[model samples]
Target: MAFVALSEAEKVYIVHGVQEDLRMDGRGCEDYRCVEVETDVVSNTSGSARVKLGHTDILVGVKAEMGTPKLEKPNEGYLEFFVDCSANAAPEFEGRGGDDLGTEIANTLYRIFNNKSSIDLKSLCINPREHCWILYVDVLLLECGGNLFDAISIAVKAALFNTRIPRVRVLEDEEGLKDIELSDDPYDCIQLSVENVPCIVTLCKIGYRHVVDATLQEEACSLASLLVSVTSKGVVTCMRKAGKGSLDPESIFEMMEVRLVLGRCLDLAGSAGCLLPPWSHCGNSPH
Candidate 1:
């Protein structure tokens, strides 16, 4: 996140505003900052999406490769999450310095997707124990405004929605050797159901109140923040805290209430059906 200097009076004003359930942007406590989502933006990847929440920008690319199924889940395929905090986001993240934060974010994603309900892993299996499609979800951090976890989560969800797993056919000979064939038509593919995918909402505690979709400057003034992942149907998937300070149980519960309200709006707004650009024609491209 960029370091913006804020005077003591400005900080006090923000704190007072939050305590009264309002923000500088004129949004209520549960309102999220504007989010821009674009899918299939990168041609090099099988699936790609870019999401800009407030000023936090994140891009996700998914590549599918044939691999053996895991021993524990032979009948199911798996997803590998990789997050890269590039220097474009911050100079401090230039090399191995960002690896730790990237790993932490990736691990959190893995944990969020641990349940079978999140994705249909079995559909990715080709031959049960022999071959399966391993989905590599790579998240690239382009910018960090304030709520990084929320932005990345939205990008991941959009990328997964845009993912198209190529149709493959398996042939077994008399010798039991398996041959895999890709579909001739590139359009013949399967799209994942993103309805169950969750979006994260981070609530930062300021003064005696909490605010959603906080800006980088607001985040700097916050003591602690709650990260909540909520699906479209109002189901809470995972929860965590990312900050140097601790939060009281009462504040945590209060944050959850705001998270639920914000999650529903995001879930509806971020849905595939809602993302079809109104003015964009099917065959139109900006010159």
Candidate 2:
């Protein structure tokens, strides 16, 4: 998250606004800022997407490469997530300054997709214990306003929705040597099922209430926050408490309830509504 310095009076003003359910941007406590999603932005990658949530901008690219399957999951392929905080987004992220934040965001992404229900990994297997498709999902932070996790997760899901892996077949000769052949037609490809994909919702605790999609100024007034990963069906796959402050048990439960509603709304908005631009809305959009 990008740092913003606020004075004591500014913090109090923001905190008071949150308590009254009226944010500085005129949004309610649970309302999100305008989100814009565009897919297939990078031509070279298998799939790519760029998402803008208020001032925070993120771009995600997924490249499918051939690799040997893991020993433990020989029949299934895997997804890898990496986050790069470009210095262009913030000068403070120049050099190695952003590595820690990038690693932390990447790890959180891994945890959110660790479950089998999130993606059909077995479909990526080219050959049992021999070859498989490794989807390297790379996220680049172009800007930061607030709610980094939620924006990144949305971009990732959109990129995965746009991903198309070249179909391949395994052939064995009489000598038992194996060879892989890619589909001749470029249009003949495999698309992953993002139906069960989960989106992240970060709820920041400000004053006696919690808010979603907090801007940098509002984030400065927050003490602790909760990160919740929820699927389209409103099932929570993972939850974590973030920040350096303590949350009471009652507040934790209250945040969980809010997470479910907001998560479902996000899922529905991305799937059925106009999350993607009107021109880009096609059969390939997430459903």
Candidate 3:
């Protein structure tokens, strides 16, 4: 994470504005910046998408490859995430730098999609215990204004939606030999059902209030933030706490009570009471 150095006066100004529910960007506490998503941006890959939120830009690509299924989940396929922060995005990402930050974001993504309901893994399976499709998801950070986690999540969802794995059939001979054949039709492919794919929403604690989609300056003024992954159906699949400050019980509950309607979080609602669960906590900021 590239740190934005802000003076004490500037921090005070940003915090005061957040307390008044008016951010410097003219957004409310729960408001998010305009999101632009473009899918199938890469022709060589199976699926790809580009997302821009304010000044932050993210690109995600999904490549489907045949491989053996994991031992434990023999009947399902899995996704592998890799993040690359361009040196041009920020000075801190130069050379071998920002590797830690990329790994942190990748780990957070792995946690959010670890559940069985997040994706239909069974659909990716080509055989009961032998073969399956391994989706290699690669994320590239073109620019970093702030709110990297949220932007990456949105890009990933769009890329997965655009993904279409080629159809293959297995033929067995009487001598117990098996042969695999690929479909001749280019349109013959499997579309992944991303209905349950959750998006990460970040809430930064500023002064006494929390805000979503904080810019670099706004994030520098905050002490800590909470990351919550919620699906289209309002089901929470993952939660993570990050920052160097301590979060109280009340604030944690407030972050979990975010109401998501049609992909927009309007305000806090009581229906999320049953969705909160214990999650892993980290000391580094993933912004």
Candidate 4:
């Protein structure tokens, strides 16, 4: 997360605005900033996407690589998440400075998608305990204003939506050795079902109110925040409290209510309209 220095008076002003349901940017407490999403941004990757939320920019690429299946889940494939906080986002993120934050964000992503309901891993398997497709989702942070988690999660989901894995066949010879062959036709691929993929929504608690998709300035005024990941059907897959301030039980519940509504809205909006392919309008590329 990028740091923003705010004076006491400036913090009070922002907090007052939130209390009145009019944030600094004129959005309601539950409103989000303008978001731009583009799919297949990187040509070499199996899937890629770029998402800009406010001034925060993120690029996500997913590469499907063949690997042996895990012993515990031999019939299923898996997702590996890696987040790189580039120095371009902030000078403080240079070299090893941003490693801790990147690790934290990556762990959060893992927790959010740590369920069978989120993805059909079995569909990625070629043979039980033998071979499977491993999707390596890599996130690159280009800029940071605020709402880093939300933007990254959105970008990841969009990248997954755009991903296509080549169809492969396993053949056994007379010696009982199996050989894998990739499909010759590029169009002959499998697309992952992203309907159940969850998007994260982070709510920043300011004064007596909480705001969604807060700006960098607004974040400086907030003492605590909540992160909630919800599926398209409004099912919360993971929830966690972040920041230094502690919230009472009642406040926690209140935040959960707000998270539910905002999460559902995000899911519907993202899945229904925001994630359209880049060439859908220009008719230049095949979807």
Q: Sorted on lDDT, highest at the top, how do the candidates line up?
A: 2, 4, 1, 3
lDDT of 1 by residue, 170-210 (tens): 99899988899999898999888888888888888888888
**TM-scores of all predicted structures:** 0.91, 0.94, 0.90, 0.93
Tens digit per residue, CA lDDT, model 4, 1-287? 78888888998899898999888776778777667788888999999989887789999999999999999999999999999999999888998889999999999999988999988999999999999999999999999989999888888888888899999999999999999999999999999988998989898889988888889999888889989998867898998988999777877787777766566655653454374343223322121
lDDT at position 200, candidate 1: 84
Which numbered prediction scores highest in TM-score against the true structure? Answer: 2
Worst 10 residues of 2 by lDDT: 278-287
For every candidate, C-alpha RMSD to the true structure in Å: 5.4, 4.2, 7.3, 5.2
C-alpha positional error of residue 154 in candidate 1 after TM-score superposition, expressed in Å: 1.0
Candidate 1 vs 2: which has more TM-score:
2
Pairs clashing within candidate 4? none
User: What ranking emerges by TM-score with the best candidate at the front?
Assistant: 2, 4, 1, 3
lDDT of 4: 0.85
lDDT of each: 0.81, 0.86, 0.80, 0.85
Clashing pairs in 2: none
Selected candidate, larger TM-score, 2 vs 3: 2
